[model samples]
Target chain A: MESFSRIPSHIGIIPDGNRRWAQEKGYQKKDGYQHGITPGFQLYEILLQYGIKEATFYGFTKDNNKRAKDQREAFTNACVDAVELLSGRDANLLVIGNTNYPAFPEALKQYANHRVHFGRGLININFLVNYDWEWDLKSLMENKCLASHEISRIDLIIRWGGRHRLSGFLPAQSVYADLYIIDDYWPDFKTSHFLDALRWYQDCDVTLGG
Target chain B: MESFSRIPSHIGIIPDGNRRWAQEKGYQKKDGYQHGITPGFQLYEILLQYGIKEATFYGFTKDNNKRAKDQREAFTNACVDAVELLSGRDANLLVIGNTNYPAFPEALKQYANHRVHFGRGLININFLVNYDWEWDLKSLMENKCLASHEISRIDLIIRWGGRHRLSGFLPAQSVYADLYIIDDYWPDFKTSHFLDALRWYQDCDVTLGG
Candidate 1:
């Protein structure tokens, strides 16, 4: 894609609205999660085509641990499967955050190792499990670890269905990041939507350059 | 005191140029910090007269702890003394985190207790000691522990020499919050500047009246 010239080096996604999508389609919530995999795959492929090097998917937040065990297990399995499939791709995969619930660190660790063996970086498919934004921010700021200059240089950020608040993910970096918000459920996001976001990002880059 | 009608409910100060202020005045940095107390007192009186309820003072951040222990101890003692004096005036005081070098919680607990004993909720003073904006913002967004609302609902936010990039304070509340930045050094802030900021706050409040 010629538009690859403007694709972001790192793209973060807030995958939201799995329950709503499932209910809307008269499927069990687990089914909604299962269905979500297709769109995720499509988006990943499109990002790859556009030459995006890094993608962070907001999978299960710490809050997700509150769901029923069966649902949680299903979601976790989906995540592991997604990671396994993506491992075969050229891009790296990382699963971030401490997997505290379901005591699934071993499972996550095993998948992460597999991804690495497949040639991805140690943290390529990052999943923020049991993450606390407040503690992290405090540590960074106090330690003077904020990479302010680097972050302000970002080209684009794509938010899927989640609201537009910094959420402690690179606040300093966002000042210069072109932002795109899609109203559709994250699980329903398609390749076309991803491309549309990329187009908007390209337009922003051109405008900013001019 | 006619400006009291336009006073800001919240005011923030960045005490910069301590070493420079000291050097210019032909005094040691310690002397500069001591000199800062006089203007600080004047500012407090002005804020009180103007009916401002919240005043955030940027004291030592985590980075400050890296200074010689003797110097750090001196600064901490000075801060403690200042709080003691303010506590005598029946002020509601809070110590905000720069989070890297945590002040002894006991110190703050003692001061808070003293304030409760003094019987005054009319004045609230907070020291953003080693404060990290990222942690604060993240807690507000993910924890649900923070009372979440629209960002637009925030009456006013004052940043004294603070940068604009949200840094880590992301997912800005849905409501729009009024922002004010002052150029004056925190230690040198005067009653006139306080009054001016208050007037602006009043104007903003009126413009966005509930």
Candidate 2:
């Protein structure tokens, strides 16, 4: 068992490769996403076990909503089921994304809120449905509301299947953050993989002025 | 001439060891920082030569306010002068800290704004002073603001005279950024180091979904 002395206070995950995982398993692409529910839930449990206080999963990007109607519906169903399962556990749920995805299902939104309202422990599950970093920064700068100093602090950043760069998630804000990249595809992501990531976080140093 | 293809979009400097740099030159710490200004400006010119757009200097953390009154005044004077010099150039200046330091002279704030306004170009030069990342993220989340995500965006992140970890600066956001760490102390940082970092950025591949 890895020591939990250095468990990260927060972790962010970019879940990737549901379609590929499904195709590889000889299941429909949607089936691969459906399969992701269990592992994603288990991953949350493992994070909780290691005393991680916060985790953010990129449930769906704005681009995902651009898929065909049938495909979007299937993906939404999978997401709804996944949220339901994870919400049953004792963790906060935060859904972060742009809120403008036309294809975003009401059921998923309702389910996410339901999880927050009923979860055993307060979990921050946010979805960024229609978020854009540049616009936000521009607005902040224009309004003179942008704080000159430190605004947000991040402990751990997890990217499940994306490339190294941020792809412009939160550019101005992430001036300083610890990052963890996982090789497992989002659909294939398992509880053990999350545990492994947490284990790495456990050893990360947060010393000032290093 | 180094290729501008890999120039870093964003650069961060810790501006460490003014006292040490001063001692090395057989001068007072105050003299070291005053002398440091020339090289810092020269480095900025090099960044412009390489087509770099954004740069941040880590000057005067919150702890600076806690230092001896004389020392803090001297540091603030140097900062004001530095700001004046950069503001006269072709750069949009961003002062990265609250103007709440008692030790800081009030005249410096207006000088900073005046210099930035004078530069009047697309160039962005920011100073990260007394900034905290965690609180900023929370405010964004609470206010329902979204961060932008664009294709092939935000090429590189540089940490000068700082460690690899996030250490509470933009914790949630920094996870996805590509980082470059330098061994040179901030006071000793030069144009070559800035160019080297830019070179690395030029060579970085920004393709997504790998």
User: For residues A1-210, what per-residue lDDT tens digits would candidate 2 score against the true structure?
Assistant: 567666656566666667777778787766666766677776766766666666656555444555566666676777667766665666555444434455555656553222354456744544433344444354454553432122234566676654445554554434445556775677667667766666776665554432
**CA lDDT scores, all candidates in order:** 0.53, 0.57
DockQ of each: 0.04, 0.17
Docking class of 2: incorrect
- For model 2, how does the per-residue alpha-carbon lDDT over B120-163 read when each residue is reduced to its tens digit? 57667766545444334434555543221111123455555444
* TM values, all candidates: 0.49, 0.65
Best-performing candidate as measured by TM-score = 2
Native contacts recovered, each model = 0.03, 0.25
Error of 1 at B19 (Å): 29
Error of 1 at A137 (Å): 6.1
- For candidate 1, lDDT tens digit of each residue in B1-210? 564445545555555545556666677666556656667678777767767776666566544556666556666766766776776676676665533335533465454311233346567776654444444444444544331221112344544332322222212321233445555555566666655655666654332211
TM-score of 1: 0.49
- Which 10-residue window of candidate 2 chain A scores lowest in summed lDDT? A144-153
